[model samples]
Target: MSTITLNDGSPVPWLAFGTGTALYGKDASDFVKVAIENGITHLDGAQMYNNEETLAAGIKASGKPRSELYITTKLKILEPGQTATEALRVSLRKLDVDYVDLFLIHSPSPANKEGKLKALWEEMEEIHSQGLAKSIGVSNFRVEDLNVILEGAKVIPAVNQLHPYVWKAAQPIYELCKERGIVIASYGGQTPIVRAVGGPLDAVLPAIRERLEKTRGEPVTSGQVLGKWILQKGAILVTTTSKASRIKEFLDTKNVPDLTEEEVHVIEEAGEKLHKRIYMRHVFE
Candidate 1:
């Protein structure tokens, strides 16, 4: 597996496995084992997912040493009269881990965004300095909100997890994070295409078939093509599924093809013109 070094100089696998609402119970357990066996060392989870128990079971079942895995979990924004530090402690208990490799502020909800992010970020910095988390980051933050945090931040965020796909490049925020030496970890890597007019598989297969028929090219799946594009863009790609087969397919990084610069340019132009977003919300409003 390819790797990206965090601002803290810690190496994380480029293709991390995510656990969300869809991954649970036996399915998650099997998928986790399959992913690790297939060379995936990074795992992403969140407090809001409500599947940390099952995720822990899967990790224990995999029997991979904790040192071999890069586990990430998000801190839930606190409710009225609640505190961010308390929220993080609750997440830590649910994951059954004393420390996480990375901890991200899940979303800039109203509860945490009405000038509370500055305090939350300060708490995160304290967590890192105290060795409770190896790194800290934010998810779904736009450029403006990012600037708010950066303005008062003593510790720079190491990662920005956001929705990024073929039709949603998020270039402004991507560029901003790059300027600040932050790693951009992308979800929805192929989801937009997968959930498009045709299924994810069908969408790419026909194009490959057409290209082969026209130019005598070899075959490749849409998932692989999309994954390769994300790698080319210099962001870590994250995906989650309950299927063991699917997890194994994602971990099959060998022989992955690269997108030509022209092809990449075409994708960027098309994506920019489309401007589609699956998860849209105002962070500071």
Candidate 2:
């Protein structure tokens, strides 16, 4: 698998098997093990997901060496008198690892609402310096929220994980992150297919898929077309599924022909026809 290099030079897998959404609040050991066994090396988890221990169990069951995997978890909630470092240490314990590849502020709401985003980010940087988290970033952060920390951030966020899709491309944040060297890690890349079934992309995806099938000389699905769209847009895709076939299909997206610039434009235009958000509605609102 190819990797996306961060500003700090840490290589992250382009496609990650995420333990969110469908796996949230659930024991994800089996799914994690299956993802690892099927060639996915990056595993995305979060303190908010409340399944890190079971996720660790699945990593153990996969029999893949810890060195062979890239693991990420987020800081969800900081308790009273609790520091970000302290919270991450607890997460490290649950993940059964000394350090994670990426650690993020789960959302800007907590610290931003409290007017402490800078302080929280300093703590995140401190943990990074202590070798607790390889890279630090934020999730569900908007331009205003990012500006809060970026104003005085010693370490600019390496990533901003968001629910970016055809319907909601998050172009403003995306452009800003790109300018600042922060990569966008996208969850819900397939939202249009699953959640907004009757949208404009319904008519658009099949024609694009047909063209891709001709180029790749194999069958293509609407999901792969969207996956290609996400990749071409230069964002990391974080996705999950319960089916083995689905996992393979997603993994195979890396092998498909890249989407044409026109195809990408068509999809984007179709997406603009209807706006929908499957998760983290607060981020958009």
Candidate 3:
């Protein structure tokens, strides 16, 4: 399996199965079962999604040993008077797992985004120390949010999940993550194509896809091209597909040759022309 070695030396698969808003509380188990059967072993979930039981059920249905799977979930909110540790314990009960391979603070605290970031991160560090979470990270966190955490952080986050598709490249934070050995788990790696269908990439991707298919001797897709771009940048991909065929297409990207550096530049350069942001909402809102 292709994996990225996190800061703590644990491995996370390059292709992750995601349980996002659309699948919350509905058929998460069924699709997760599909994902597992199709060779997906990493699951990305969250406490805010209200579907931990569904995800838990999916894992049970797959019958894959807990040790064989890499599971990740996040702390959705820090309610009034609730500590980060307390919030995670509630998630543990819902997930029915003693320890998540990766746990994250879902986002910067919206109410007082900067005021509490450092302290919340410290609390996350404590959860990691207790072995309740094997690794700790953050999601949808921008560069400014990170500056505060880094000030007094005893443990640097192992990963940072961000929406870095097309125009929303998140360069500053992306560079910061690399300099610090923080693995990036890209959630919208393929969203631009999904949203743009016949947009800018269509003009250039068909030829690149054709060239790559020749290189690998297998059918290559625009989705795969986008995935390959993310992969070539040495980032992990968080993607979801409810259909079996689509799941296979996602895994198939592994066999193809890496996109040339120029090709990657071309795609991003094209994306820069169509700057847009997705996944900008705070879950608490």
Candidate 4:
């Protein structure tokens, strides 16, 4: 897997095993072990996941030295009167780790915007300075929100993890992050699965699928095509699956199919035309 160097000079693996769903105890431990065994060097978690203990146990089961893995966690924005420092401490206790490779602000909350986020950012800078976290970042932040943080920030955000799938409305933010040297990590590569499971695949309508199939010279599913497109666009892709076999399938990016320049352009144009926001809209608003 390729690695991207952060502004702080720390290298983070491009592919990460994201554990955002509810999984705890033995189930979480097993999932982490399977992920590590399958060559995943990066593990993503968050305080809101509510399964840090099991995530830690899975790390222990992997038997890989703690130094060998890039562990990432996030701070949930506090309720009124709560502190970021307290949030970090609770995350530390739950994960049972002395330090994490990266810590991100989960979203741009009201608390986060009203001076508290600056306080949190400053505190995160202190954490980085004190070696509790190697780097700091934010998730679901638009370019404008990012600029707000940048104004008061001493440390530049190393990563901006967001929902930037091929059929989504994040191209402008992706371009902005690229220009600013911030690595963008995308979730939701399971467009096909969503379609198969009777969920929406809005941008990948039947006509678009037919066009992609004709261009690619194979019956390409929207998920695979979008995943391939994301890689071609130079963004790190993150995906998760509950089924072990599906996880293996996602890891098999070895023989990545290529899309011609014209084909790529067509897809990009189609994406712009049909893009829909997948995740909840509260973050962007």
Candidate 5:
């Protein structure tokens, strides 16, 4: 798989293995090792996930050199007077890594009550300068939240990680990130199929799948069609699955035939028919 060059000049895999709520507090070493075995070099973790210890276990199990892995972790909710530097120091100890490929502000302060975005980002830049992190970015940030940081940020955020489900995708935010050279990482890569199980895509996805299967001379699943849609949109994908077979299916999306122009529009049009958002616990609210 090819890597997406970030604005900071760092490379991240187009597909990432996510240890979100699904693997929270579980021994993910086995899962992590499985992901690595299946060509998933990017592992996404977070302080809030509370699974870094096991995350480390998985990395160790993979037995790959640290240099070959692209690790991403995020700072938890910012407390008053908190700094990204100190936060990252704590995370480093937990992950047992001297440096991470990417780090991020987990979320904006509750309605930005503490008003620490400027202070946090300044320290984030400082952390990058110290070589603690290769790139710095944000998660769950709306356009208004980013505007506040853009006002004084010297280093443009390297990426923005959010749900970005097709139905509820905010096109303006995607375009905004594109303009700023901030790559988008989507955590909800399979949401279109998982949550909207029988939605409009069901009607058309099967036909698209048949066309792809015939062209590729292999089996095609609806999930791959959705994954291709997200991949074609230039957004990095972070998908989580405990099953090995499912992991292979997701990684194989790299080989799936590209969606036709008309097929792409069909997925988007179906998404607009019903907007379903799964992430609602926003600190920015």
Candidate 6:
């Protein structure tokens, strides 16, 4: 799998198998095992998903060495009197690992609303200092939230994961992260194909796929087209599905032909015709 280098110098897999959404609050053992067996080396998990133990189970079932897998989990709001270190230790126990490749604040809502985003980030820095997580970051963080943390932050965030469709492209956030060397990790990349199927992309994706098929001499789906678009834009993709074939399809996206500049423009223009935000709307609002 291709990798992206974080600002902190950690190598992150460009495509990660996310253990959320469909696997949320459920036993992810079977699905996670299947994903690993099919060449997915990066696994994205979280405390909020309520399935870290099951994710561990799947990891064990896959029989891949811990050193070979790049594991990541997110931190939820700290409990009463609970330190970030304490919270990460809990996640580490659940995941049965000494340290995670990456750790993130699940959302900025709690800390931002409580007026403790800076303090929360201080604690995250503390977690990194203690060697509990190789890298630390924030998810669903806006430019405002990032500013709050960056103002007092000693360690620049390694990444900021969010949904980045063309409609809500998050250009401001993208620009800030780019200036600061923070990589953008994208989820919900297929919102146009899955959630809002008949948007402007419908008219454009087919032709792009046909062109890519001729270049690569293979079939390409709209989903792969979107995934390739994300990859081409230099963002890590966190994607998941219950089906093995779908997992293979997503993995195969690495070989899909890149989108031309006009094709990318067509996608961006189509996305602008309508607005859609499938997950974490409050973060953008």
Off by over 4 Å in 5: 79-81, 166-169, 283-285
CA lDDT of 214 in candidate 4? Answer: 75
Mind giving the per-residue lDDT tens digits that candidate 4 earns over 136-205? 8888878777777778578988888887533455877787788878887777655434623343444444
Per residue, candidate 2 scores C-alpha lDDT tens digits across 151-209 of 97889999999876534457788889999999999898898889878878899998999
Please provide TM-scores, in order, for all candidate models, with all chains considered together: 0.87, 0.97, 0.94, 0.83, 0.94, 0.97
Displacement of residue 32 (Cα, Å) in model 5 is 0.8
lDDT per model vs. reference = 0.73, 0.90, 0.83, 0.71, 0.83, 0.90
Clashing pairs in 1: none
Deviation in Å, model 5, residue 67 alpha carbon:
0.3
Model 4, TM vs. native? 0.83
Q: What TM-score would you give candidate 3 relative to the actual structure?
A: 0.94
lDDT of 6 at 232: 82
TM-score of candidate 2 against the unseen true structure: 0.97
Question: Which pairs clash inside model 4?
Answer: none
Off by over 4 Å in 6: 166-169
Q: Model 3 over residues 1-285: C-alpha lDDT tens digits?
A: 388899988899898999985686566999999899889999999987788888989999989999999999988777789998888888888878899999988888672454877888889899999999999998877777878787768999999887765344487888888888888888877766776565676788888999999988878988899888888777888988889898899888888888888898888777776645567555323
Q: Which ten residues in a row have the lowest lDDT in candidate 1?
A: 196-205
**lDDT string, candidate 6, 1-285, tens digits:** 489999999999888999998888999999999999999999999999999999999999999999999999999878899988998999899999999999999899978988999998999899999889999999999899999999958999999998876445587888899999999999999888888888778899899999999999888988999999888878999999999999999989999978989999898888778778877777666
